[model samples]
Target: MDMKLSGATFRRAASTVTVIGGSGFIGRNLHRALRSVGARPHVFTRRKPFAHAGRVHPAVAKSDTIFYVAGSVTPALAERNPELVEEDHWNLNLLLWGLRETGHRPLVVLASSGGTVYDPDAAPPYREDSPTRPVAAYGAAKLAQEHALAAADWTTPVILRFANVYGPGQTASAGYGVIPHWIRAVHARETLTMIGASRRDYVHIDDATAALLAVRAHADRLRATPGPTTLNIGSGAPTSLDELHRHLERAVGGPVEVRREPARSFDRTDTWLDVSAAGAALGWSPAIGLAEGLAGTLAATRHTSMSP
Candidate 1:
């Protein structure tokens, strides 16, 4: 069976886009954006992605552009399984060999965590140039991978240090997402817990992908010029967990019960972002507000979520 993108799509997907772990939340959303631009996205994953099973990699590394989005989050996952995380990050470097043979150095977009890339105390909103003092295994691993990409001689490396991303279809389980968790807790009549009330800049995935595509538009110019550009893609304003909860309540149309858990020892007090570089460089800024984004996400979850 021929497993190629359609003829019309071929024009846009000419330079095959490989998104490792593209089936994951961030990657799936990014793939949607890539398709909109007529880019054929091959999701390199262990399992077939929901809609694009054929695009699943039986053997990838032959693709043109490779976006590495596979990694573990949650402190427990990272703390208890550091070796697996390290291996995943290390394997990304191996892509350099295949990328080298393609003749065209594919544009590489790394979905790094903006909320943890820099020390919270150094600046009001974290910047790429800010002093980085990652306190968790997850942050440390991402930083090390960024260093590896820098040294790997990648054709064009754009590091998107992303803020806490929340939108529809985001997992509301114990592992991730602030808004959905609240929605679930509210729906379940469980407790909505806030740890440290740590402030963070939240970017809707729609806005996040817009920021990424903006960077891609400049990849050619960026490749000709040496130097990997590190950008923080987020809304500059910081919203406290408490504030986010208030917004969540309004969006869900409810007054949910609340509980405060003692701040985790590893948790950063607050880590908003400074997106000036992305704005100045890529001319991208997040347009979705908290309540509006959350409201949309809530409606979307009703349709897409398994539990509802």
Candidate 2:
């Protein structure tokens, strides 16, 4: 899984691109990669939300490809404030409306949730066609978004259900990534919160970015086929909370404190994805192992802390 593409490959894919929500963890990395590879990318951030007015609609109208990575709520946030979920769905509808009004048929790639969208009872390593039964509002909203894209016959949709993605540039915050939260806790010498013996498939940001580019490169092939193309993007391996704690301890050269908590009713016990379809379709697989990725992230966190 050497996830490197030459500039010529990207140039051949598309001349113009639009990245909705380009300020977030995944979008920031994807936007930078596209620019580095000589692709023209227009970004829309939360500070300036996309709307029918102004330059937003125009950018969406003329894009050769569009990456919809805009999301406002995490599982915890969604559970606490369900109204945000409705707002998210409304925003997506607005985008779809703009595309239809302009008659723009671009390749639209959606970043979905693989960790929450699968049925908790139906075994691990869920596939694209696996039974979807989201226990939380976040997963339900994502599934709704997927359905909306699938129904929109005007644009070509490529739905990517991603596993728990973590790497450099991800910061610790409420209702955000668990890995970063734990890393911050470890650095601050605080107790790492363990909820319900949860296990998940964590993919590095670099690998996730590579998969997005692969989809872009093969956009023409995807558009030619009928209906929306759905795929799972992940490492296809599961890691437990205890395993991750040990990895972090080894990286920092000390024992990390731990605190146990009962699992929330909305949480899933364990989940991972079967990413063989992505490998076969896009010729992409996760290259970074968990231990290696975690070590690199810990080093970056240290550097960030030491900086002025």
Candidate 3:
């Protein structure tokens, strides 16, 4: 299949990307990517502005582009505090609607949940056509927001169903990233307990960013094409828990003790995304596998630690 960015698909000069939830893990990385591409990125955080404070918290005016990767994880938080989820949905809609009200046709990119987006048994190696049955409250919330985005049109909207994104500079104790938590435990010389088998298509941060950027580069096709475009970024290979432990051990050579526990009901034994659609549509594919991604992330983190 051929993928080209030209004609009606491409919109001209949508600079000044406004990133909502720019304080989150994926948002930070994506913000960097946008800047690297010479796209002026406006990071909208809830905190009192610092750094480029003038440009940091710009009003929700439709300008260039918008990448929305802000949302909460943890099923318990969503379950116990449904109001929080409702509030997020409300704030998220208002933000997007504000953008729509303005004449800014931003190539809005949404960081959706790949793990919880689809049902556990909704066909192994889920395709984009697979039926979605979210088991977790967070996934349902994301789905609702996705629908809202599809409805609220500005210019172009792309939904990135990101797999479990893991890398350095992540806080494991916050209880989100599995890889970061495991890496921290190993680094701190603590024991590790896994909920279920480690089988998952762990896409490296670099690969995920690259795929998303490719979408930006080809925004025209994405925009001309009717309906919201969803792409899955992953290694397309399931790395089981048993396999993950051994791999981490080999890489770090640390005292990585493991104890088995009852897996969370929301957890699946094995899950991975069928990335062929991304390959065919975006000319994007995951370059780094689990072991390679882990190695690179470890090296970077250790280097940061050893820096003077």
Candidate 4:
């Protein structure tokens, strides 16, 4: 697909942007990117995000664009504490309600999970129209969030079903953030545990940020429309655990000892995403490959670690 959009267009479109979870892994990078594109972003986030549904201050009702990235590390954490899963749903529904009540119709960009939304038993490269049979609590929560957005009739929503997003600022010790976890283990020379042979479609943060910017640039048209539009954001390439270990080894310039463990029953064996719709709709495609993305991630992580 032909991916073409000028920077000036993005600047014009992203005049007033709002990010709910601006401190998050993706949100931080997105906030920075939006600023670079000459957009004024209002960030709304609590000091303690996992505590409960932090009230959405009425001040955010003026934003023309809103990116909903505020949610727990649900993939690994939600299953343990089911109560936290509802926090995102409640917060979003309340936020939408508040926006409508205040007469604000911002273009909402939701971060959905392409990795968990579809039934793994059905197919490999899951599309936007695929049947949503989330097997995990996190996936179920994400699906519910999608439904809530659909129900919110005030504003237009662009639901981006993201794959395993990995890049700088990704936490290493949360039982999630596999890429960062591996990088940290390599830096510390710790044993790398190979839990399962399951493959996942990993999308770099740069590409994800670019897609968000594109969506923001088209926010006006997207909001003018009535229904919500969903698109899959991924590299469309599946990488196995063993392959990821090898990539990490190359990135760290050292050997990693793999400790094979039993795969979890909830884990999907092979999963990828079809991003053609995003390409066609947003005029965007992933420019960074996995190898280069890993290198950039390692470089950024090292820089962060060495900083005072």
lDDT of 3 by residue, 151-209 (tens): 87665778888888888776675557678877777666778878766478788777787
Q: Highest lDDT, which number? A: 2
Per-residue accuracy of model 4 over 29-93 as CA lDDT, tens digit each: 88888777667777867773322344456446767778898887557787788878876788778
Top-TM-score structure, candidate number: 2
TM-score of each model, paired residue for residue: 0.87, 0.95, 0.87, 0.92
Task: Report model 2's TM-score to 2 decimal places.
Answer: 0.95
lDDT, residue 166, candidate 2: 96
Q: What is the C-alpha RMSD of each candidate to the true structure, in Å?
A: 5.4, 1.9, 4.4, 3.0
Model 2 misplacement above 4 A: 1-3, 6-8, 11-14, 53-56
Itemize residue pairs with steric clashes in candidate 2: none
Q: Model 4, which residues run further than 4 Å from truth? A: 1-14, 48-56
TM-score of candidate 1 against the unseen true structure: 0.87
TM-score of candidate 3 versus the correct structure, residues matched by position = 0.87
Greater TM-score among 1 and 2 belongs to: 2
All candidates' lDDT scores? Answer: 0.72, 0.87, 0.72, 0.81
Lowest summed-lDDT stretch of 10 residues in model 2? 1-10
RMSD of 2: 1.9
